[model samples]
Target chain A: GSYTTSSQQPSKLLFRQLFEKESATYTYLLADASHPEKLALLVDPVDKTVDRDLALVKDLGLKLIYAINTHVHADHVTGTGLIKTKVPGVKSIISKASDAKADLVVEPGDKICFGDLFLEVRATPGHTLGCVTYVTGDGPSQPQPRMAFTGDALLIRGCGRTDFQGGSSQQLYKSVHSQIFTLPKDTLVYPAHDYKGFTVSTVGEEMLFNARLTKDEEAFKNIMANLNLSYPKMMDVAVPANMVCGLQEVESKPC
Target chain B: GSYTTSSQQPSKLLFRQLFEKESATYTYLLADASHPEKLALLVDPVDKTVDRDLALVKDLGLKLIYAINTHVHADHVTGTGLIKTKVPGVKSIISKASDAKADLVVEPGDKICFGDLFLEVRATPGHTLGCVTYVTGDGPSQPQPRMAFTGDALLIRGCGRTDFQGGSSQQLYKSVHSQIFTLPKDTLVYPAHDYKGFTVSTVGEEMLFNARLTKDEEAFKNIMANLNLSYPKMMDVAVPANMVCGLQEVESKPC
Candidate 1:
């Protein structure tokens, strides 16, 4: 009748994708299988769904380790700050190039480790100057296909709009082509947000089907420029809150 | 860029969860590895998102062989008829007790197989007269934790309402305890619909955390009777349409 925490599953690595409907944001939970303590981390958790996400962690008997952001988001405040406030000792991580405040700062070539699993950081800036993609280990030696957490640089059939927040279409085009597309085609791509109900995609699928990125660099830039998209409704409030490890003024509800 | 179907991955099995937002329904695409033809099946696909679902199936280069419904849903139209129309020769499956006209009728103790993988059919009829939970094999021999496609019988933290369509809270309580909950505690539980943005839960998690079924049978029945749920707006249209293997009069849009 109530939430229950149980150490039930053993030897299975945890990888969960949670959603926040209002913003269509995707939050990822990753953990290592061999770690008895069940150290875990959340990526791109939204402020509105922090309680739900934390309850999940508690129910699964996982110890929250870090709250990670691929970049400073333009929509929906990040849950990293609230998560820290709720779960003491939980650290926040952001890219050093993001120039945002966080407990830990990372850059290209850095690896974030939890138990036996690790994610390689890749500088993939285009939608923003500091966006990065986190990728799990890939190779014939690995047990599973690689996973690439491409925040806004890439999506299922499209890429994020490069119209504001120091957005550059050219940089994004180059960033994805060089950094993300080059990964093994089978690598699972988990974007920070999806609007079309797509939960996941593969590098190969995007390489063949991605509407914007498949175009030449010039064509991609023109498409980005000509598309007169509306300004994000939550950008004004979300960007500021997300910039400082997600310190939101609103205490009760999401902005 | 356009949609591309690449035969890229060599070894990984495919299991994707697709969402149709209007009804908060989940559609599962499951396939067996080791099959070069990439035979696949869909579970509880919604009609409104048929185009999106087909595109995904095509992009993954999976051949649709079966479209199965755990039960005739009341919230949304089933995509089975449309899928069969588009992908010729695809079979539609439903329980025999449902009295629905499908290409194939399955009862308990049956195994639906594709390539090397098979889902053991479990008769968990509580939410409706003909609800079935599909589960991959458990025991130490399986590759990973078993997955139970609970449909509407059992949800993440809740079970389906036993209000209409021969729904009996008593039968549901007994059915879940005997059929679904008795599976391995580590088995992954995927429900047919989720109002909350939860995607997955474990057998143990639901066993301990299920808000409805965790209560005693009498208490569970009382909760079901007192729910005072609104009359389903789509039931009149959805029920009649889902009866004849999901044939719908509306051609262009969802009912």
Candidate 2:
């Protein structure tokens, strides 16, 4: 559902926030008068909760123009393909550097425009080989992008695992220190998953408290090596299911 | 491998303790003059850790007479089958009420004798179906049990999960109050797994500090239901592998 603001400035940008607390996944739907009927994007949508998202889109009277996956997830199943099936005209986008299959892959420094909204893709491969973060809006004249959707690359108090496929601790260190950490400190950081109780944090908070980022390379590697983390319980089932984007055609069965 | 104690007592009972701090798995090897070659029993043996236990047996010049499982574990694989395979003449025993496959399944009130050492089995199925606690004594003359191996049924400061298969909070409450709590307050409680720093506790301490048992039933159920426990990462791999007793015929692979 849409809520109206009382500001008479005629420059208010409307966006709705939805969160799947179990997975710590945050999906935002941004819309305005210029993109009323056919302009919307979904970032990191979860598989089982697609119905709630679809309801929101229908209630807002907006067409899903694109479904974006920040990266292949290790925690939960992705719903990119499922949205495409339900919303026929929507395009599924990912980093061109990713090894996973996608319909429309864009490279770094690429720009995607839907109505008045402009998204600039930045390739930030630290947590995984093809991880990317989208920078929405251009300069101060445009609405300041006060948010970033970091899919596993960065978390509130911790970082992503670097022992899995396409993972490199060094690359992640660089990605955080150079790209994400350098962002405006006030930028609200929305991570893909949060194991701890934290839901969100500012860039300043992460730069100060993130355990891995604060350690030197040698210490970080030793800490990562000593971590007795078990593999994700759904890896065997979720990976294959996500490869096809939420098992679009497969019959659902009891877990 | 063997240490000598110069105690001038008529009854000679020397016991060696092995501790796996990660899983809180404690194994005991007891030796007496009457059953030198035929009175060895292993408690709470973990998968692939059999080599260490076997080396201790060989060094002490004692034959392994029995291998026992305290309960079907949810966190780690059991090594009872591996011990049985390595020592062909040894008999593997578990509580007859267990759903898991076993050769010699004994019930509650059953007594197992090994020369001068005797163990009385008590059916304790709160943690899981077929869980049993073995009370070991030097002989009938030893009025008190020197040790009790409680597999998941009781922990140092906590209790086992009742959300998994065959687990019941009500059953657990009954098991702890009637069977375990009723035991001598000073009886040593050896648990299967303890992630919290403590290694062991007495029945009296548990009755006083066990967060679950001390609370009312409704409060206990709420605590259990809200426990933010993730599915064990190795559950899928460990369950099937443990079904055949630590992959007897299958080649071992690094976990």
Model 1 lDDT tens row, B1-255: 000011122323477888888899999988754467778899998898889999888877788899999998988889999888899978889888887778888999898877676778888887889888888764343335667899999998998989998899999999999998787676778899888788888887888888998999889999999999998999999998897657655455332
Residues A1-255 of candidate 1 have per-residue lDDT tens digits of 000011122223577788889988999998764477778889999999999999888877788899999999988899999998899988899999988888899999998888777788999998999999999865433325677899999988998988887789999999999999898776788999888888888888888889999999899999999999998999998888988878655454322
Tens-digit lDDT string for candidate 2 (B1-255): 000011112333334445454454556555543453546677767765687778656644577777777776666677777787788877667776765556677888887666576678988876677788887654444323345778788876688888775788788878878888887665667777655323345676677767688998888878888998899776776666554445445544211
Encode model 2's per-residue lDDT on A151-195: one tens digit a residue.
788876678888885888888878878778888765556677654
Alpha carbon lDDT at B126, candidate 2: 66
Choose the strongest candidate by DockQ. Answer: 1
Q: Assess candidate 1 and give its TM-score to the true structure.
A: 0.91
What tier of docking accuracy does candidate 1 attain?
acceptable
Query: Candidate 1: lDDT of B200?
Result: 84
TM-score of chain B of each: 0.91, 0.85
lDDT against true structure, model 1: 0.82
Q: Which parts of model 2 have CA positions greater than 4 angstroms off?
A: A1-12, A247-255, B1-255
